[model samples]
Target: MEWDLKVIDELPDYMKMAFLILYNFTNEMVFNDEMKRGDVPTSIQCYMHDTGISEDEAREHIKHLISESWKEMNNENGDHNSSFSKEFVHVCKNLGRASQFIYQYGDGHASQNTLSKDRIFKIIINPFPYKL
Candidate 1:
């Protein structure tokens, strides 16, 4: 079955653009497994185009929102123990770190055009010549 953007269109006009940007960003972060380093600028431009805000204002707001998200991630990774298993928490933290590493230079994983490609090839595509 084909997916649709109709649900997005159903949103109120004032919120549709912001929601679209968020949805795109989240999809890139989760499904793409990589993010272009230019995401912030792109997001700022998107917001400015959508809201008629100045570039500077859009950039400031986007950066502040990103900073807030980082703070939330940090809080989740903090030493406070919760009902979750320590291993699960560690995995979540490592996933965040791995995402940062993958996107450190560019959209390595999604584009398959960076050092990530080489690493993936070595680990998954090619195996040791000798059997265990």
Candidate 2:
């Protein structure tokens, strides 16, 4: 039961989270054990992309990016559109997360911000393992 996009914005933050969890409740709760496979929290990944300097701090503000795109991941495919597969939400989330990561440091989208560019390059390009 999806509501209008604008209506979600009007909802309190907790309700916003409820909407998401309820939307994909069946997505298995994943944890790292022996199998080494799990559901990546792309929402949090996207949040980190927006503002995480290290892996320690992570976060989700995806709606505005694709204009109420949470609909695309409703565990069902559509005409000329594909479902995000509750657990994987796939490349659409990837693109949105990329956007979050790129712009997390304040308008770093164009790569004009030297500090942001360097941060991006260091974390993504010249990367080494993060310890904490």
Give the top-scoring candidate (TM-score): 1
Error of 1 at 57 (Å): 4.5
For model 1, the superposed segments whose C-alpha errors exceed 4 Å read 1-45, 55-57, 77-83, 109-132
Per-candidate TM-scores read 0.44, 0.29
The lDDT, on a scale of 0 to 1, for candidate 2 is 0.41
For every model in order, what is the number of clashing pairs?
0, 3
lDDT of 2 at 20: 50
* Pairs of residues clashing in candidate 1: none
lDDT of 1 by residue, 25-130 (tens): 4443333232344333355566778999986787677657755555555555434445656676666555544555544443444465567666555545784566
**Lowest summed lDDT window (length 10), candidate 1:** 31-40
Indicate the TM-score of model 2.
0.29
lDDT by candidate, in order shown? 0.51, 0.41
* Error in Å for residue 75 of model 2: 6.1
Q: Per-residue error at 88 for model 1, in Å?
A: 1.4
